[model samples]
Target: MTRKVPLANYLFTRLRQLGVGAVHGVPGDYTLRALDYLQPAGLRWIGSCNELNAGYAADGYARVKGISALFTTYGVGELSAINAVMGSYAEFSPVVHIVGTAPRNAYTSRAMVHHSLGDGNLRIFADMYAKVTAAQANLIDVKTAPETIDQTLEQCMVQSRPVYIELPSDMVAAQVPEVRLSVPLNVSPPKNTDEAEDHVVSAVLSRIYASKKPYILVDGLVAPDGIVDEVSEFARITGFPTFALTFGGGIIRGDLENFHGVHAGKFGTLDFTSYTDTADLALLFGPLLSDTNTLGWSTVPKKEITISLRRTAIELGPSSHNLHIKSFMQKLITRLDSSRLSARKPTPSLSSPRDLIKNLPEIDPSAAIDQDTFYLRISSFFRAGDIVICANGTPLVGGRDFVLPVGARLINSSIFLSVGHMLPAAQGIALVQCELAESGHTPGRTIFFEGDGSFQASAQELSTIIRYRLDVTIFIINNEGYAYERHIHGMDEEYNDVAPWRYLEAPSFFGAPTNGSYKIELHDVKTWGELDKVIKNAGFQDGKGLKMVNVRMGRDDVSTNFKAALQLAGRQLMADAK
Candidate 1:
């Protein structure tokens, strides 16, 4: 006899199979019944404070665990999470967005639902999702539900982007063939033709062998494209000078002698840019060249001299070849003849962010912590395996300069540049780390650098973090408001200011245990000495549940790289005003 399971159970089971140990979302009337199936499917339910934060958390989880699921009710709930889903789409995070919609009869009768427009249009939300998600599935029939769910999830996994599944409330308990779960969904990319693979490999090798000065540029998409290991190996095998862009920071091992720090293009040091500009060939891996990621297009390598390996295609100079990036890279690595490849000596004189900090004048312990010196100084605090989350504004800009410890993963909004994303994202990332630790895997603490204004946007997620007792350390830069915005156009405008709060009281307010085994620690640091004390304290360094640090800086302070960019933006704004 063929086994049968509830439709919701089948869906949850599929997610669990794809490495989603927990589902993140707000429980609504439509999804409440389906939530009961989570435990049965061997999954945990993370009840987020709101749909947006849930979506953001799901995105974060996907970044760490490869794929994640988000459950939301119809119209209103899905709409609230659309922004985060879109960010996932743009940045290549695999998220399965399961939306619980009205019953089949309600859709047939065109019933005006409370969460929908009164005009009886219930399909509008799903239609909106179709634009942002890689694929969409509307499950109205139990007979086809199993296949639909598998195919939609496969799309999410293969494309590394969010996908939508509209599960009707009435169909939550509808019987579906459970036997289908025995056959794993095929999420792997189709194999490339031998001819095409050979041609691309030959073309890439020809350039590699001919060039005297070749460089490797690793971008953020390498991780999502599932080629980080291959790319890293290629860089290691070929003793070429390697550099990562802002978005690509921390993806590659930073400890390599050949690994120069992030290439900031026009904003970069003259010595580094001069060397990179003279390179005859560049092997660009997983290139995502959004303006912000590329420093307003300044950091983009010359296409004429670059070979770009993307998710689905390989760009050789002016032409693109249809090839699987992972397979292509694997084949290319196997065929590489190191004897023919040109080897360059490592340039040790180039100044990295670490070098900049070393060259700084002796610190005055009583001096207020400023943006220019903070990131460079704090770079020493990071350790291997740490998953660092930086917020959209100052953190993102300053964090690019971090000389991360080997194995540290930096999660920043590269293209979306969304505010309030990192805090909730920290909760999700930390949750995964906690799970890994429980499984006997060595996982580092989830460290987050957040701005006060960004923190206010999704602050309630802190309660979710505390409730789960996830291990996370948060450094809140208390600069009063949006310091990045202040640098752009408004220096002292009231509109840019955010209301002040007692940030150190967040853990207590969020319901973290005060005297129990899993306790929360808080620190307030305004000066360099205070920050050093907090960073060195044993309780703060090795705390269990949650630790919060409030580092206060000037409202107008901005990183050197960002200050130049923002000043140009301000000048442009002024010209437009004139």
Candidate 2:
């Protein structure tokens, strides 16, 4: 008995089938009716303060839960979230962006709308979205709406990037056959070719057997492309010295014997630099060759020595192959002869500067905290099964140095550099964590390393966290201003300074109880002793509800890499002035 369902139900039902537990967005005239179907389709509606925040939340959710959906009204709403969607495209986060559009009659008649620019061009929004998303679908016809919906969603999953779809306001209740609901959408990866797989595996294995010094360089793509388990297994099987780019922090479990931490070019530790730079063969998986990820492109292994595995192709030195990387990894894992692989050299402990700093003498209780000592000390607080997020400032640079336990996920923008993204993203992740816990799964805590400047940008979203009472812990690096920007261009400019707020009062200001079931703990730490005490506190250890820790540092305080970059920039500025 095939039932006729509304187009909105058909779309939301497909999203639910694809494992979308919640949808994040803001309501508008065009999308208000579409919002009504969310609950009926068995999806939770998380209304964000704005469209951009909703998009950021959706991106964060996607990173944790694999796929997420974000709804926005046409024109005004969609444009606001374009940056977030762009970030998703740049980083390969799978997000399905559905836009509630003007009715078909309005589009046919060129009717003027308030949200539009009044040029009678309703297609402009979809056109703009096409540039940022991997696929786009405009649903004006009832006959092909289901096919369009499934196709657009399949693109989002296949490419691990955003896909755009337009749902007209008046077409929400249009009749559509619900037969497709029983059949799951084909979101699987394309079938691997036997010839291509054999060639890629043979080439990679040949290089592995011939090389004297072989290394594995993991990048951020391991998560988006669904190959973390494969990569981990490969690393374990080969036991090769493994390193990561800055964006690849949490993907490789730090506890692994082969894991040697992130490779920061000349900026990395002596052993890290020696092993990576002197490698004869490098297996670079999911390489995102951004300047930030590669330490200004210095850490990128020589092209002749690097075998790159991309999403759709494989590149070995100068030669290239049209083979899927995920497929190549799967075949290589099964075919590789472990007995023939080179024996790994027993390397010394690759403790980061953070690790060494923790061994230093205890500082004065009244002494102010700095980047080097602060990040390492804070690393001790992170336990297993925690999702750590960092803002686009000192926290971004410093938090990457923290050692993550197995099962930890680190979310940081390598190239997007959106400052306020992590704050609202933490909110979305907290919501997802709550859902995972209710299903009898191992629930993880959402931990954020945010700057005061970044926190101010998305401060209103904290209210959403309190309303939902999601388990989130935020450590506000209250460094007084846009510390990252200062290191880049304006070192002492007034424009970089942010407005001062009582950072510790955020929970109460956002409507949390003073002392009740949803009890929010607050801490203001200015020294190492205070931070240590707070981390060891009973309330913080419980990790139940919202916990806020505000640590004050100098405005000029930044990581060593940031300091070096700042010095180079300063010299360049001086030369230009001359």
Candidate 3:
């Protein structure tokens, strides 16, 4: 006789097999019964304060763990979290969105449910999800449920995007065959035809060998596409100059001799821009050329001389080929003849963030901490194995200038540009770090750089972080309002301002223990002297459960690179005014 398990049990077990250790979401009426199967399936249920934060947390967890799961009730709950799911789709984070809905009887009878639109349209929410999710399945039959679940999850993994599943309340306890669980889901993409693969490889190598000044640009999608190692190895073996866009920063090893920092297009130094402009050939990996990622398209390479390698296709100038990036890269690397490639010397004039920091002149300690020197000064605080997250607004802009250590990962909103994403994302990242530490891996601290205005949007999540006692260090740039918005359009507009709060008291207010094995530290710094002392303290350097630092800066002051973009926007607005 074949063994069987409940539908919810089978679903949660598959998620566990996919390496999702925790399910992030809020407890809702429709999902309450299904939640009972999580722990039995070896998964933890993290009850978030709201569905939106839960969605953001799931996205963050997926970034660290490769895949994650989120639970939400029907219409209201799912709709609230839709924006976050859209962000995951835009950025290629794999998230399993399992939504619990009313019983099959309600759908068959066309009954109006509490969460529904009152017009008996039960499918509206699922219809909306179909637009953003890679795949969707309504599990109504036990016999077909297992196969459907596996297929949808496979799509989520292969595509590296969100997928949706509708679990009827009555089906939660329905029995399903356990035999299918014995076979692991296969998520590998289809192999390219040998003839097609060979043509693309030959084309790439021919250009690479013939070019005098060749450069490699790694973009944000490389990580989600699982090609970071391959791309890094290619760049390493070639000994070619390589640079990452803002979204791709820290994915490649930063200590490489030929590794330049982030290329910010028009905002970059003249020497750096001049070097890239003179390249005879350019190779792009997982290129995501959004306006914000490319600094208003200023960093895009000349199309005539560029070759872009995507997950499913390869673009060579005007021609396109159906080829898998991973398979093609493997073949190209094996066929590379290093001796045939042109040799070029490294440009000494291009200065990295570390070089700029080292050459800085001493300043008055009593002087207020300004945006021009803040990110550079804080660069020394980062260490290897740190997972640094920057929220949208000023943090994202200034964080591009960080000189990350080897093994560090920098995460920011490259396309979604959500304002309050990093704080809860830090929570998810820190939870994974703790889980890794318990499993005998060297755990890293979750460092978050947030804007004052953005922090208020999801401040309740801080209490959840304190309850879990995750190791997270938060640096809040208190510029009194949305300084990033101020620079873009309004210099002193009331709409750009945020209400002031007692920022340093957040730890206690969030219920961090006053005395325990885990300690909480809070500091308010206004001047360069105060900031310097806080960073150098032994307690602050040690990765603790909860640490908060409030650094005050001028509202109009922004990073130099960001200031350039803002000035252009200001001029555009002025032109519109006339």
lDDT of 2: 0.85
| lDDT (tens digit, per residue) of candidate 1 on 196-307 | 8998899889999999988898899999999888988888888698888878888778777777778877665323677778878888888889888877777777889999
Candidate 2 local lDDT, 178-292, one digit each (tens): 9989999888888678987897788889989888888889999888878898999999888888888878878987778777677876655323776667779999988898977
TM-scores of all candidate predictions against the true structure: 0.97, 0.96, 0.97
The 10-residue segment of model 3 with minimum total lDDT is 265-274
Q: What is the lDDT of candidate 3?
A: 0.88
**Over 4 Å off, model 1:** 269-271, 576-578
How many angstroms is residue 265 displaced in model 3 relative to the true structure, after the best TM-score fit?
Answer: 1.9
Candidate 1 least-lDDT 10 residues: 266-275
Q: Model 2: which residue pairs collide? A: none
Clashing pairs in 3: none
TM-score, cand. 1 vs. native: 0.97
- Arrange candidates, best lDDT first: 3, 1, 2
The collision pairs in model 1 are none
Please report how far candidate 1 places residue 363 from its true position, in Å: 2.3
